[model samples]
Target: MATGWAGDGAVQDQIDATVEDAVKRARNQLKKGPGLTHCEECDAPIPAARREAVPGVRLCVACQSAHDEEAAFSGYNRRGSKDSQLR
Candidate 1:
């Protein structure tokens, strides 16, 4: 479903790349290390389960959801990443 100069599936490829980019970001956080016992922003007690589940997590579930939403709004369009390859 490529819509630009790229051949078929370019759009889908970009989508997959975008998803991969997000997953990488989350994975990078894990690589850093687990977060503190309390929430970084609110100081709420972080559950042991969450801490064990996702290392290097900064925000609690509620805060993380908000943070993710904000990040989604801030993401730059990657259309050029593919189009640039054409040249």
Candidate 2:
């Protein structure tokens, strides 16, 4: 049922990459540094709820949203592969 580059490590690669990204992101999220403060970017109050919800959380909600908007990286499963060639 796959089509185009969808067949080139398509589903499996995407799934694997997703899992990998999740693991990496989870690792980063789990990492905690000394902190209890406001958002450096927007000076918004870092809610206790958010600090608790995300252990090492930085950036308030608004700042986080804006940062996400500005983040330039693509998702983990975006491209097929460098070695892949369309034909």
Candidate 3:
């Protein structure tokens, strides 16, 4: 049944949209083809063990750590605040 002003399937549509967006983001992050032998950012040699452990790896430990730090601070919140809940 419809809730509030939205139609019957409105909540489901929102859920579907959120899932689709997450999948799209994940797919974009996935690496295709073989893993790089060197770090693309710092040009450091990516260890053989790393390459083997993580298929399609591109960055070395240092560069990957920096990249992870940057990504963590990218300010994209998957969930909004309670203000959004009031909607």
Q: In terms of lDDT, which candidate is strongest?
A: 3
- Which candidate would rank higher by lDDT, 1 or 3? 3
Model 3 earns a TM-score of 0.51
Clash number by candidate, in order: 3, 0, 0
Candidate 3 accuracy as lDDT: 0.86
Give the per-residue lDDT of model 1 (tens digit) for 1-87. Answer: 436878788778999999999999987765457667888898888898998887776778888888888877845556778766666
Off by over 4 Å in 2: 1-29, 33-35, 72-87
Please provide, for model 3 over 1-87, each residue's C-alpha lDDT reduced to its tens digit, 9 standing for 90 to 100: 539899889999999999999999998888766789989988988888888888799889998898899878844445877866676
Clashing pairs in model 2, backbone N/Cα/C closer than 3 A: none
Query: Compared with the true structure, what per-residue lDDT tens digits does model 2 show for residues 27-59?
Result: 976748644578887787898878887777778
Candidate 3: which stretches are off by over 4 Å? 1-29, 74-87
Against the unseen true structure, what C-alpha lDDT does each candidate score?
A: 0.79, 0.76, 0.86
